[model samples]
Target chain A: MTGRMIQRIAPDALAQLSAGRSTVLVSGTNGKSTTTAMIVAALGGAVATNTTGANMPGGVIEAYSRSRARVAVMEVDELYVPAIGASTLPEIFVALNLSRDQMDRMHEVGSVARRWSGYLDGSEVHVIANATDPNIVAAVGTRSATWVDPGWAWRQDSVVCPRCTEVLMWESARWSCVCGLRQPVADYTVEGDVVHTLHGGSLRLELSLPGAVNLGNAAFAIAVAQRRGVDSDLAARRISAIDDVEGRYGTIQVGGRTARTLLAKNPAGWASLLPMLADDDVLIVSINADEVDGLDTSWLWDVPFEELAGRTVGAHGVHRSDVALRLEVAGALPVVDADIHRLAGRLPQGPCVIAATYGSFETLRGRR
Target chain B: MTNRLTIAHVFPALLGTYGDAGNVSVLRYRAEVRGIRVSIVDVLPGDPVPATADLYVIGGGEDAQEMRATELLRADSGLSMAVHRGAPVLAVCAGMQILGEWFTDGSDSRVAGLGLLDLRTDRRSVRAVGDVIADTTGVLDLPTLIGFENHRGATSLGADARPLARVLHGIGNGAAEPVEGALQGSVIGTYLHGPVLALNPALADYLLTQVVGDLAPMDDVRAEEFRANRFQRARA
Candidate 1:
């Protein structure tokens, strides 16, 4: 019910949305929240967004109420994308990448892919999309949406081909065919793993998240910043300065102690991030199935956890026992385990790494 | 003594983004666990395409990239040779799109492919975004709920090739009904991004086996460890 009301109210901003109101809508699965947040963070104005990560219909309405910023930065739900309606066509549209996210809530990616099918058909608004995603690749040139980050890179395991079970190929994770698809891949990057995109001359960014996906997110943000008339170099510099979104691979310090914290909500996200964990550090890992983190944890069977190393380690969360059992099955190096609340004081005196899924962080954040 | 595996990644050039580098980290982690070392050789647009590699990987890209990379591969005259020699090649998303006979962008402009896979691709979509699930099929496991279903075109497999998976979500061949996955030779294709190693160890095992098969003991032990770490961290 609330979802319908918000859709009705979204057009309320149309009066304020000047033909002059150039805006950005960065959408996708994992990176949508962080990438949208990064755009909102660096590009100051009455930037509106759903930073709480409520990408559904109500969240979009909530984002609008939270800020009257001339430039709106918001994350769009993959399933609810159609709910955005016509009033919210952003002046600048950005997509980090198209991947399967929550299953219980939405149809297959192709459901939304069908909606954006016109994306290949063409776009009047300045558009930004990851060059690597096939759905987006298929759309380019037709709608004339500009492709960004055309380079040689590849995702592991990969998005399967619908016809054959084979994985797609890559040159660099970046590639763009002139099939009439045109967009410049972001080149100027800020230090510290942040990307500064200069699309239409505006600038925006301040993300420290790891993963080539985040880098693409930052790059897309830079492109939006440029589209909004932000300075390119400045935007690039701003992006490289930070390190994370709250739990989507963020780092945190707890108990007046130095510990980097991060969140991995699913198998794909975890797969991309797990390789980066420091082997030498004492680590505390957590998991939870709160709706925000996707209620099912069975995908846990899909992750590659043996990489934790031979150091001291512990686990906790709503599914703590299950996690422990998996660890035990792996014959992991044994150590004393504690729940999130009991972790800080019990942690070894060293640079500690606290990692968790969605609900686990609330408990850890209080300890922080 | 450490066993180091040299990896060669063939990235199709001129696509939209290069976020696919995540695969290297996944490969490196698996190798590191068994006390193995990984050295990477990132082969990009301008670089020389190698004829043989221990493991071959390709990522997603835009339509423009498909044509550019495909043209470059055709010009190289050696990539097909490498795949023919059974170089366990892996392609994801748009990379897979380009490997087939042709892919027409949304504009209906068709670009030719290297034709390694007996399939044809076109830029058109019946769906997009969110939980694209597919059950494995054919030479591969016929049913696996892998993530990622964001593509505008539909892929149609040829007589000789088998599908990578059956579509549990998202459209597979531009047809309204969900089909299976894309495949050719040792290569498997999909749009389900994220370092696949993190979630589906089976996929990781397949890739590792093709490369360091006997050298790596990636039974349930590796899968267990990977899951334990992520699950542990997810716990608050």
Candidate 2:
């Protein structure tokens, strides 16, 4: 309702309102909301952001209209980054890893990377990019930017070089293509719990968010904060206080069982989050095919569900049958139940880990 | 001893855009359930196409990646020889476009395809993306083929090609003619990428039978239920 009304009332309002403010646009397949929230918290002092997960243009306008802050940090959708970049003239643009996401609605990963490359070429915005992802390296490698190697786990989208189409050569910590494209030397690198800078200084990050991916997100957020002259230690302290971002990685009680809801939207996200689960964890995988969920469940095959081969699993949501079939093929018998509360009741004792898509996660999070 | 069936997944890294790799998983799962031994060989770019495989599968990709995949596939005569030797091939979306005579690239320039099928593809102004229901009754002997269609290519078939199905719901080829995909000899190509084989088990079985001869049918209640649910959702 708010988005439509804002769209109708002032179609050009975003361009007008963002004319004088210095903006930072955060975009990627995953971690946009969390990273943007971390940046907002780290910057402190009247920083405006789209906390409602409305990263689109209208939502951005509504967010800006609601705040009187001069500095704005906004999460822009990957596909809409070019348009938003044009209108916002952002001071800093953070490029996270690119991967296949919502195949039903999104363009292939290569096309999106190429679009980002076109926008970044000859532009004055300072780009903070992931050096580990070959797609990101190919996108913004030529331009001078602050590259960070937070490490990438999902190689399916980066197996073939985006520039030369040759198979990339993968080594222990870096990857390179025979055509001379390679992961850039990082201006900032994450080593264990500490982030090392090239200038012989480092910040030990203590992130409250779970998973190595969140640490990587914090590393990027710290880099952005450092560029803005915010104290690195102060930024790390601020980021560590954020335990949850927009209901992600939050514990909720349902049907007398405690569960931590983790949002795994794509193959890359699943690759990062699945390893955090223990062998005996009660796993509930939920899926939905609504407009936000992309209406296609074929990506389930790409995920390494075989890791849960010996575990007891529960499948819930509109696409429970699809999830059940995937799990069954992966050598696990899954109980298919559409009711979340009922599924929660059947979970084994101890804390459960619930991995869900966008719609399923939102529905369960709303119940809290 | 059970006879082992070898399936070649072509350029999975380049051509797997829309969970299209799920098609290979469905084939393997269905085959394993029926007590048939299966071996999957992933053929990456620059790798030699294993011509001895019983079946070949390729999925969708981005335009640039598709063009590169077509170039690599055309350079290797092994796939063409395998197709000539009667190995069944399943190609989806961008893969389907690359198996044709030619397709439009990013600059609207025509790039040559493998020419295994008598078809050509050109980009349309508007992309056709939504739920698709096709009537494959006579062709594949399936009830109602259900899947999701997302493509911008307007493919036209020649005399040597016949459509695998007729579009009953969404746009198929995005052309004035209402055909879905082209089928030539043992080669099948379509834009339906619910990883089409997962939703249409009969089609997977048909491709399997083409290699292993007539086989007894196993219970496909789960596949049937999945199809029914998707069909109902498409209607809704």
Candidate 3:
């Protein structure tokens, strides 16, 4: 739906909102935006979302201001934590790992955990949480939760072990806890790098979006939808038909070239998109401190740029100068940063992609 | 004229905000700009705490992270010896809480800390997010560090380690000054949201001197220019 349609039709349309028409609330430190968009498509038509992607109260207010659908599948940031909980906390809540995110704005993972725990405490709600996380599964799960669904994605990414607060063992299959309590979680499995629910059948979390994390998100979306009483067969069917999540693994066609569009906020999100690009594809990036974008941009590291190999990349943003320079320092090949217009045009000459964090997506959405 | 030193760190994975990395990063960056190396050690706990590392940093995580970090640190006699030998460590948020004799878990369970420092941590109520600044001997121009407090626990000062700053924003030692942070040896812990090193450069420089001493060389003319330019732009 266009931004204009959302503003004008979203509110009045809610009166017609139905229960089977599921609205999934994707909450966590990372991967919420891309996952929400992908899962929305997985749920098929009759769904609307807020792409302003603020994750705060004002941002959601800005989103709901425009969206119209049977289900209001929305994203929530930690700053808007209390408000979202107080207002539009959907019937189904899919909480990704409560790891540390923007420390400048959101507190560490515990901050989110503590907040979510109390909010969810004693509520007879369906919670799709990552079971492998010691915090979510062990500590929180030990509490009285309605239903527990484990995550299969992000089993291999470099993350903190819940116990040691150190990097968990990045095993070939999945990560291991350093504290001896780390179990070899085999049932919590991933195929084609996607997390699969026990009942969601064996179709790789093939939600047109690329990345194991997306697959985990797909699983969570499917799980949440199921909890909201969507039929298992229909939810499964709808998820399989999914084919996009917008700028987050969305695409653009400029002239004869195809540029895969990705929005990377932190090094983790950056790593998720890097693997999908061919070594020879051209790349564009944007970063900034706009609004609640969490002004601390030091997280650009931790993204193993070496994994990108020798691909040539170009970038732009309000912090274009900083983004450009950091890429240079990290040994990335630089391209021209002549405004988003120039970069958009030059980007599609080769197999290319555009990545940005902050409202930089406006340039992409407006261009389309 | 001596060059100001500053160290900028990308820390979220390290300390997991249990909210201490802010103080660590803020203090280091603020100090280094005045001229200190401020070696940024992305030390994953239990991996080898680098020998004689000038400053140690950690953040909070799920009770699991705290349990694991404390256990891992306890297992390492060598690292604890290093900290005991007078290494200037700056921990914030969760970092400071884990330094003392013990930390209570989510179940109101208690676990032993490194004992290299003295302090105690206990899980508290849920709603702790608000402006926090502590009144203390160490004066900073910035008002109470503006950040949210989303932790479910609270720390109590022990006999040895002292409360670094009075509770400024939220509850510190049940309403004391320079509250959410701690100070023992060179260690300073607080719930200051990374303390945001780029904005508070003075504290950053102070942290750098702890590790690299006062004479370390840095060649980032652009970073200096960038900091000055950003600060200037904000003012203008």
TM-score of chain B of each: 0.81, 0.97, 0.70
lDDT of 2 by residue, B1-236 (tens): 34579999999988997888988988998888778899999997889989899999999988767877988998898789988988999999999999999999878999999999999999988888888999876677666777888888999998898888998899998777887898899999999988699888888988898987776778776677678878889898
A1-368: candidate 1 lDDT, tens digit per residue = 34446558665643333234455666765667777876875575566676777676567666665666666776777655544534566677776555444433343444456666554244466667765666554434344455565222234323333222223443544433333332235443433354433333333334455555566666666667666767667666666665656554545555566677776665556666666665566677687656666644444544556665455566667656446544543445434345443565576667677777766776666632
Report the C-alpha lDDT of model 3 over B144-171, residue by residue, as the tens digit: 2333344555666766666655653456
- Model 2 CA lDDT for position A20: 92
Q: Name the weakest run of 10 consecutive residues (lDDT summed) in model 2 chain B.
A: B136-145
What are the per-model DockQ values?
0.05, 0.60, 0.16
TM-score of chain A of 1: 0.76
- Which ten contiguous residues of candidate 3 chain A have the minimum total lDDT? A12-21
Tens digit per residue, CA lDDT, model 3, A1-368: 54334436664332233233445567776777766765665566666676646565445555554555657677887544444654554666766665445545664555566567667774544566665554554334444333333334433223665444555665553456556535333233445644555554554443555665666666666665555556545665676565555556567664355667777776556666777776667778776656545554545534556464344567577666555434544456555564765676755356677777756765666642
Which regions of candidate 2 fall more than 4 Å away from where they truly are? A1-7
Error of 3 at A6 (Å): 14
Candidates 1 and 3 compared: the better one by TM-score is 3
Across A320-354, the per-residue lDDT of candidate 2 in tens digits comes to 88888778778776877878878888767766888
